[model samples]
Target: MAATPAWPPRSAPRLFVAGPLVQDAQVTIEGGQAHYLSKVMRVAPGDAVILCDDETGEWAGEVNSAGKRDVVLTLRERLRAREAVPDFWLCAALLKKPNFDLVLEKATELGVAMIQPLITRRCVADKLNAERAATIVTEAAEQCARTALPQVAAPVKLETLLRDWPESRALFFADETGGETAAAQFAAHSGPAALLVGPEGGFDEEERALIRAHPMARAITLGPRILRGETASIGATALWMAVSGDW
Candidate 1:
């Protein structure tokens, strides 16, 4: 006899629910999610929905009932455990709205553990819409099939971040002025680490001095080409993931 196929097909719609996906438990989704299921996906009863509760992990569920304003799902089995996100953080200076938005999306897809938006003297934007940023990351996680979601922190000034820096995490500063090789430095460190990139105008002289003087700060070089703020951040993150992240 032929073996049975998977319950939630590969093409099944996936979502990240609000955690604690207990076995055999039913969940009720509402608001935007409810609208998405009913109106957008048109998910009916007995439809398979792959769910990922950031806390519990991936699960295969079936839509038990669908209503105009709510959709109840019954979880059948856990598909996979929550991902083992490496101890990595991206302390990126805020760029223009569109550019920073790209950073959030790609950073989530690239598997960074946390995102710390920074404000520098050269920054064009000092504030971040936390709610909008969260949505972008969540959607990116869903698209990339990420089991874990990176925390989107409130925007802070560069100096504030440095002052509260944790000793255990190595800080890799993307110095346009240049220092150690990028990949080489990443390969040298393990455990908790962070990559800090500058804004459109790049880090100011004083800012650079402060960062470089920090005991935890190690300068990184992205070859000879000076990339735009968003490019540098995303590119460097990808390199870090390849060299030191969960590649």
Candidate 2:
């Protein structure tokens, strides 16, 4: 008799569901997820899969029912508990669709706790498709084997973000004008923090003043050479992960 393949295939699919999960429970996966499993992956009853509720860690389950529009799986065991993600947020000014999408993907891989889209005066893409962004992050987390999904908030104006900034969270502003190196800035501070990256055209003078005046803001320079909006966001996140987060 052949041994059962690992409950979750070596390449486990990352799923986002709403709930508090329990062992030996039944879960019904529907919509695009169902279509992917049934038609794309051709998963059948008894096939193993991994499930995550974004609350209760990762679980190993087997397909109990498979249909065109819906698939049901019964929880067999807990594969791993939810991981503790870094207390870091990427508050970036909206970029063009491509760049913004890249930020969302990489941010998830970097283990950011949240992704806050900021709309500055110079921002190129003020409107964001939340559903698509969520999908991108979900796929990214799955590929990177991340247990927790980073929360993606809707795009808000820069002023609003600064006005409502949480006092306890440090805001590392990547100021293109001038400031300390990112490494030095990160080394000097610790605890829940956020890195704010400006848009493509960069922040206007008025926007810059608002950011600089924010009590929680700390200006940090990426380097002498200017980096693209997406590059700055990813680079800052990577630095923070290495210096402060779980690398």
Candidate 3:
């Protein structure tokens, strides 16, 4: 007899649903998700799809219904439990569209818990498309095989972020001017932390002072050369994961 196929096919498509999911239940994929699976992926009935809810784990499901605008799936089994991501938040000043998109895509792949976009004096992109941003992260998580989607918060001012900052979580601010090296600093603090990356022109004098004075903040240097906004966010997150998170 032939061996049974893996519950979740190796090449099964992965998607992020909104809430809790259970085995032997039906789920629907609408809008862009539907378009991608039916049109782009060309999935048909019997083709497996891996479904993940941010609140729960992963499920092995097969396409039950497919349409031009919608596709329905029925869960066959639970594949894996929800993964424990690092307790890291990427609080970055907003850059231009292309650069900010890069940060969202890369940070999701790096497995950050949250993505907080901060509006500073030098921020060129004050407004963000929340729906589009969410799509970017969701797709990134699906592509990277991440079970949980990173929380993409609405844009907030730097001052507000500082004022309402959690006292327990450490905040690592990437300061080009002066601070300890990222490796040493991250190694020193392994608890819940957030990395703050400035915008294209960097933070202004006032903003820097406010961040430095914040009780939960720790100023750190990326390296000798000044990196771009997106680079700083990705590099700092990767370093933190290596030093303090699962490597």
- Candidate No. with top lDDT: 1
Per-prediction tally of clashes: 0, 0, 0
lDDT of each: 0.92, 0.89, 0.91
Please provide, for model 2 over 35-130, each residue's C-alpha lDDT reduced to its tens digit, 9 standing for 90 to 100.
998998888888887888788888887889899889998889888889998899999999999989999999999899999999888887789998
| Per-residue alpha-carbon lDDT of candidate 3 for residues 10-87, written as tens digits (9 for 90 to 100) | 898899987789878889899988998999999998889998998778888889988999999999888888899999
Model 2: lDDT equals: 0.89
Model 3 TM-score on a 0 to 1 scale: 0.94
Give, for candidate 3, the lowest lDDT window spanning 10 residues: 5-14
Ranking by TM-score: 1, 3, 2
lDDT of 1 by residue, 21-119 (tens): 998999999999889988999999999888998998999889999899899999999989999987889999999999999999999999999999999
lDDT of 2 at 36: 90
TM-scores of the models, in the given order?
Answer: 0.96, 0.93, 0.94
Q: Any idea how many clashes model 3 has?
A: 0
Better of 2 and 3 by lDDT: 3
- Model 1 alpha-carbon drift over 4 Å, by segment: 1-4
Return the top candidate by TM-score. Answer: 1
Question: Clash pairs of candidate 2?
Answer: none
**Model 1 RMSD to the real structure?**
1.4
